[model samples]
Target chain A: MDLQTSKAPSPKLPHTALDRVVPHSESDWNDAAAPAAERHALIKSEAAGVQLNLGELWHYRELLYFLTLRDIKVRYKQTLMGVAWVIIQPLLTVLIFTLVFNRFVRLETGSLPYPLFALSGLLLWLFFANAVTNSTHSLVSNANLITKVYFPRMFIPAASVGAGLVDLSVAFLLLVALCFYYGVALTLQILLLPIFVLMMALLALGVGLFAAAVTVKYRDLRHALPFIIQLWMFASPVIYPTSVVPQKWKWLVTINPVAGIIEGFRAAITGQHFDWIHIFISLVITLAVLASAIYVFRRFEDTFADVV
Target chain B: MNTAIKINQVSKRYRIGGLHPGYMTFREMLGGLVTAPFRKLKSGNGSQTLWALSDINLEIGQGELVGIIGHNGAGKSTLLKILSRVTKPTTGEVELFGRIGSLLEVGTGFHPDLTGRENIFLSGAILGMRRKEIERKFDEIVAFSELEKFIETSVKWYSSGMYVRLAFSVAAHLEPEILMMDEVLAVGDAAFQHKCLDKMNAIRQQGRTILFVSHDMAAITRLCRRVVLLENGVVSFDGEAREVVKRYLSSSLKTGALKEWTNQHDAPGDQVARLRRVRVRTSDGVTTAVVDIRQPFGIEIAYDVLAEGHALVPVVEFYNEEGTELFSTHDTSSNWRRQPRPPGTYTSTVQIPGNLLAEGSLVGHVSIMSHFPATVLHAQERNAVAFQVVDGPAGDSARGDYIGPMPGVIRPLLQWTTETNELSPKSNVQSPTSAGNS
Candidate 1:
């Protein structure tokens, strides 16, 4: 049905009658607004040479601290066991490994007791495992903040690893007590334990950052990561000493970054001879993986906000 | 004048119906990797690209309070995201001077497990505030939120209002050189909204550049002297706040004084009835988008009843420029008000007298509902038709001789009575005791 009107047939509605209708202003497209000599942030589609700017990271250090603090607070507040769980998990794992390793395999553990031997390796392994696990899901879990706010995206995975450090410190107390109970004497080699721990941390962070970035795009990593970690445990010297492996397969142990770090860490705690070759191999692999992981992470960082 | 933000040829392209659907599973990625050669043979199929923004150029001067107004999908949020560096544009560059803060949402990064006190610090840091800055403004933020008693309690237990209050308070205390807020004030109580408005006004006085995106024309006109209207990822109008807002509101309602659906199947309705048309017309039966304040106008709703034995009530609601619903009316004078409407077409009209609505853009939403047996709303259309109420300054109508801002939802010319009683000496000089007794 047509709209009956006294005037001509019209399909479009007439403009509303108002006093002093404002005309469209001139589109003052200013292409020549000279940039002043002031500090400014320029956001472009392609970031200029994704630099691992230490200074920028230092500026956001407080955010990194707060995010880590938030993770620790929230993680502890939700559970009844709280920090005690950190000690209990590693302690029970050490007990089970000690019992099984002693009964199943007859290998010389030198002078150090099997329990202390397993605990030393287990402590560093557990820290590395937890840090990797935590950091892998960090980007996906904090997708809210990543999409809404602007900060160093790496800080998310970094904070997850940092939170694990707190737990490692607490569980370190359990290792010290085990040493005291076993009447183990203090030695100069214990000073190198921190270096091994640093190597373990570097390896964990490298793997974690890589996993976190990839997990943002492929969430199946979340399901597959646990299985990978479990297999990686057997590959490392968490349960048995690396000497038992055949010479032909020992090269595999050398290339396994965490295997060397774990053996070196146990040696430092037990006052055994340091494996300089293995430690050097671990350092090389750790730095390489860390550098490559950071490169891969920074490459995927720009698209995170859009896809996450 | 120094430039605060210069958006140069910025554009954002998003892939639609892509192979991965935004994110992929590892299984799918591996499968895609295996079938990459096969998929290359069948390329140019599913994925479509959308340029959310297209070479939009804008230069905002420092200390300018600009309001960005647009409809949904008009790329206002995308622009803000690009400027705030939440996401990078597909092409183009945005330059910003000084420290910038963008609040696309309040309480962003707030964990429910954390206490209100912890969230204040966490959220503040997320918004780019320093720890020392948060500590310095801690008490002020708490006071602004009016949530001092529950500051230590976990946010999970706080009411939504309290959460919003806490979130907005922290955001308000941020002292960035440039602040971009997207509809943050659309929450909280009126009093709290006013407090936020006051805080924003104070921020403006500090010569800090602010970019506000909101659909609330009232707030836009109140706070921003300059406004930008975006339509389909392009700047359509950029000028004075009042002029830009008027164009924005009117342009949104420009489908005119008459809306019709000839196809019964495509009309908005259920099985009971379908709305065919909604029209705003003068008493002379001529459709119009503008009406003189001194003349009565009628909003006519025509609908087709598909099912019989249903008492249908045609309703019309009027809203002003500020989005306040002035009033609603139904066909209470209908002959079939108590009877069932037959399966046929019907028309209902509600006449609104002149000088009853304030002089501004008036939008009407029409609906058809049934109240008998069970309440079933068949159709409801929002902003169906809009008309401007023109109240000329001729010393007539409700304004009389007043020539200033008339702030009210309605401007009805109601009757009044007055009596002038001359204050004689007898009553004016009455004693306090006598006045109390009287």
Candidate 2:
């Protein structure tokens, strides 16, 4: 339980100051005779170890909670409609996707109504997308705090994702209601819903970490991230069902992790799950991407506070 | 016993360079996204190493009050960040033995739209105080901050003074084992500043450790027992207060007091006399070292009093850096003071030192005196010289050779005023100043 040795008193409290002042002069300031800057250089540059120190993180849990809550509160503060926008954003997006894919492109929605169908995927996918994208720049955006006090740097991104969950849950209630409104029968496959949702969260976190790390070193990522996410959404099966993809290119389609998540989403709510082979492949690819994201993020984590 | 905070060879390296301008080539904005990221990838991280602190090793005993001092570009902030753990060191280690609470910048971590009460919880949590602990101290914090009525009001509407009082109150009230504050005293109005200083002293009275950084030398002298000076990312000095300040002051080499020699005397019949360069220094002009307060000192003025049909006189003045005039004197015997004078180079001096100044930079002025502020006989001033003071080694003998904290600018060698009453106990009455409303 003792975090510190018994020797030195923690120099963090204010006491009766004796004003034992020691002044240093200009000749002392320009102490070229001052020693050279030294550092612990033997650590491997390519192999920074992974440490999930839950205790330290736990010690700071309340701070984590407040910060996440702050983000959620601040997002809607001074705004019209306040929390209503949480539902409107997803609702509007569903309408746009329905128009663009179902009406114009005329993609078949099988037995499910196109609006109800796409809305579910949109709600879940939107959360994953928003959380990932926002988390990507969380650390850099809060540079003021990052540069001033010490806390687990990972909490910044993690909190952003946590805050997004509130909106996700709100938009999701409408998705659930829409499925029932469409006369879709509830299936036990819904049990697997949380699994895919989690996978989506992890997937976002991985990509987000990589992007956040890259953004600090190159601010251009700020401009590129939205474009990248937009293009990525099309590549995923959000607009069209994975079932419609031609067999010849299914290999490439399965490689995209979101492809499996969206298809699994349809099967979970409706009854048309994608091929098991593709779903498993998507899971594997998602894990691989996440591991790489963690690795890349850890490699550059120390540099973040400096440049940001 | 081991030190409370042991900084072992800690050093931080920052990258130096700017990010590449927006995406794509100069032509790419017009050409679209085709030219970018073809085969190679290019984006953000472009910086080199700028070591903020190098080979810094120090062991702070438990409950030691340490003050950090330095000029612009010095690594004082960097060192604080490292100790507080906001930023990781590129090399070395920081071994902390107790809880650390930092007030890096007031009102920085507050959310503008959040009510003052919400911000208290938020800021407290961010400062590492547990929820239960904050709940316990909640009322006391509000009472100390004197914002009970405005607690529910959002910080956006809080006046700057109100904001500072609330923010500083929260930080000061935090019962952390170690506290790190940056220039917290150099803020707000005089009354508020006094309150902060009182609170700071109270915090120290409890056996807790603290690290403070300030530009106000007098405050530093009053607050810190051991002062460390940094210059250009390195520790410049680490000794007694008076000695360090004296060395910094007397060592001034401002291009040997520039001489713009001009003989524009008698250019006009009315503006006959002209003034040359004026320089202020120690009585012994050759002793360029900083003037010591314990001893007497003088400022020198040089001028050319040409034959003038009009009256001419010279006035000398002294002012602290705050522009507060300590005192001023003049040559009432000059031509302007009495009659006219012939053409010749003349030197004038002003002298004083007996408990008349404070421990800070002083500037002097020499003006051509005339009919109630009317100039004509070279009414220009010689450059102001900076001098520092050191109180005798009498008070706070524990901080031997150090200019300990004392009230007033001059820090006079005054007698004591004291009365020892019954021990009502230090436990019951909390210091009646700002406390954290976390």
Candidate 3:
């Protein structure tokens, strides 16, 4: 008998103390013996609209924490390198770019080594790319949870973005060591590094939520996503500096929020010129994309359980 | 009596067999958008809409354990889904008074790659348990699952039973004020099922409101005092548990006491014999879909003998609602035992005496067998007819005024002889009349 014969404890009765009082009618629901009224909720069949309920999101914050932890843990479960692979992805990309650019195409990188400049930009780029790609498929992958349980559906895509932060922070430490080896002096501009990372997150979340919701209805996005991302990577200044773009075509960097953030991130780390106008424009676009993505996500979320 | 949940004028409509069905890709959807205006004239009539639920209004009081039972497509799941807020009703509102938790399925958010220990916390949080609550009762959950030895092992390697145990253990510890379960007890081994039932009973005693949806009639009748029966997206019956369960079982039976084959060429049989019709009737020979428990009923089977020179026997098998075969009766008359009938139609009937069969739905299977040099089944029909056996309030049958559920497939009234010993040293023995009255 593999079953243990230990006596299971009697489950706790939450209402035992209160039930000792005399019974009351339904009208006395707000009385002392009754459950607090704040727990009451009314569910209806109306469109969610564009209402933002921060309190509801706050209530399910623990679920977001657990889901993000699960993603991070499961991503490295079977791999031999585990967290080491997190640093390896950006390092290997920097290695390939450094070899190709330094030997053949000599695009001038200001003051700092070309390898250091590319690694700094790839830090934000890879996080944005990985976060967007993973969150895009998060809803479809967790279809079982969507149909069976009730929670903030947005947390699913949001957690994928959160998981990418763990990898980003680990890769950030390697960039710090390389900075010291290159003897690049740090300055007050480095304080703005966190702002750029925040912008990158908002942008990824905006695109991820929209794509995840759409993919639930039209699955062809799953096949077209990698190709779209490959082309998007070329448009962003990951391997090269933004200065390489001609002055007439500078509007490309202005509209691409990720390009501005990456350029801002590299500038901040190397203590170079900060593109204030471009960073400000990227912030505005990031917020707009996030707001609209949330709108489309909220509208489509009601039918996700039915169709997914 | 505070209302734990209230559902108001709820109705859900789903489009069926529509042009835009299930899911569409981006390209196909784009094509739909281009041609939608042109196709609008033919679209409305081509699609069909089905109302899964219509005008459902229910107010459940706090601390009530209710059972909901219905046949497939009866809208039980739809109602549960609405209450749990998994999907919204097309038109309705539901007000809930407390922290609502629903276990529509076990192991819904389990990650197989995570270890048993990690999954316990993850699954617990997904089921709406606070991290501190889970941490406080973590050991209890592991103990209840009985997988303490393998807590650190990945769940992918655990057997299915172990996985269900871990998932259910996390769910069992959830202390929601109102919980809705949909056939969650339909798994696991018998011993584990018994343990789960015990845990549910404990939860019920804690004054938590529970809405249980299941097809297990025995469990429904045993655990719930109130049962609701849904039929065709409407509430058909709501009251005492046993009565409603009884109604649900009999109503689920095929609504026919008689089956007939109008075309003899398509009837069931080889060249030897063919069945034409089968029916259930009382002693008065009136065909009925329901009969009294204390009244005798007959199954009449009419068939045609095509090329018969061999002796044939007609048989009828009786089964209860649970598909347990109660008894089988055959034509045993000596005159027809070895008699070979000429090519013609023959009618045979089997009489089941009063107080012999249980008070539930009974299904009859009719067949004909040829017995001469070798025994061979010539014609047979499964589920030929179904009829409900009802117990009267007078209780004159084998139940004999005892109103509780009688545990047997057949309830036969038998004679009993009682003899009191006069030479007994103990005076506690009462007289026969007194004893019988008591």
Point to the candidate with the largest TM-score.
3
B-chain TM-score, every candidate? Answer: 0.64, 0.70, 0.66
Q: Which ten residues in a row have the lowest lDDT in candidate 1 chain B?
A: B429-438
Clashes of 2: 45
Considering every candidate listed, which one attains the maximal lDDT?
A: 3
- Model 2 lDDT tens row, A1-308: 12222223533323222121111223322334222211111221112345444456666777888888998998899998998988999899989988888889998878888998788778777888898888877877788877776676777787888888778777778887887788888789887777778777778878887887777766667777788888888777786776687889777676888888777877887766546777788789889998888777766766566667
- How many clashing residue pairs, candidate 1? 0
| Best of the two (1, 3) by TM-score | 3
Off by over 4 Å in 2: A1-54, A271-278, B17-49, B251-316, B329-353, B366-381, B390-438
**Candidate order, TM-score descending:** 3, 1, 2
Q: What would the per-residue lDDT of candidate 3 be over residues B1-438, giving only the tens digit for each residue?
A: 999999998887766665546567888899988988887787564256678788888889999989999999899998998888888887888899887779899887899999999999998888877787789778878987889999999999999999998888888777677889999888877655655565565556668799999887756765688889998888889998767876786566664788899999989988989999999988999887767678898999999999958699999998887889998988988988889878999999889898888776778989999778899899999999988776643546775533334578887888754433242446676454432444
lDDT of 1 by residue, A22-47 (tens): 11121111112212311488887854
Interface RMSD of each: 11.8, 11.2, 9.1
Writing each residue's lDDT as its tens digit, candidate 2 over B1-438 gives 446678877766665544323222234343445745552344333233466788787777777777788876678888887777666676777777666778778865788899999898888777766676568667767876789999999998999999987887667656556778887677787656666665655556655688888877666655666778877677777766655655444434342222334555522122444556555456566433345454566656666665645455667677766777777787774444556556676776667654556666666666765663365445655444445544433443223333334345454444543332223446686343322421
Interface RMSD of 2: 11.2
| CAPRI accuracy category, model 1 | acceptable
DockQ, prediction 3: 0.32
Query: lDDT (0-100) at residue B364 of candidate 1?
Result: 93
lDDT of 3: 0.82
> How displaced is residue B369 in candidate 2, in Å?
9.9
Model 2, C-alpha of B203: deviation from truth (Å): 2.8
True lDDT of residue B351, candidate 3? 90
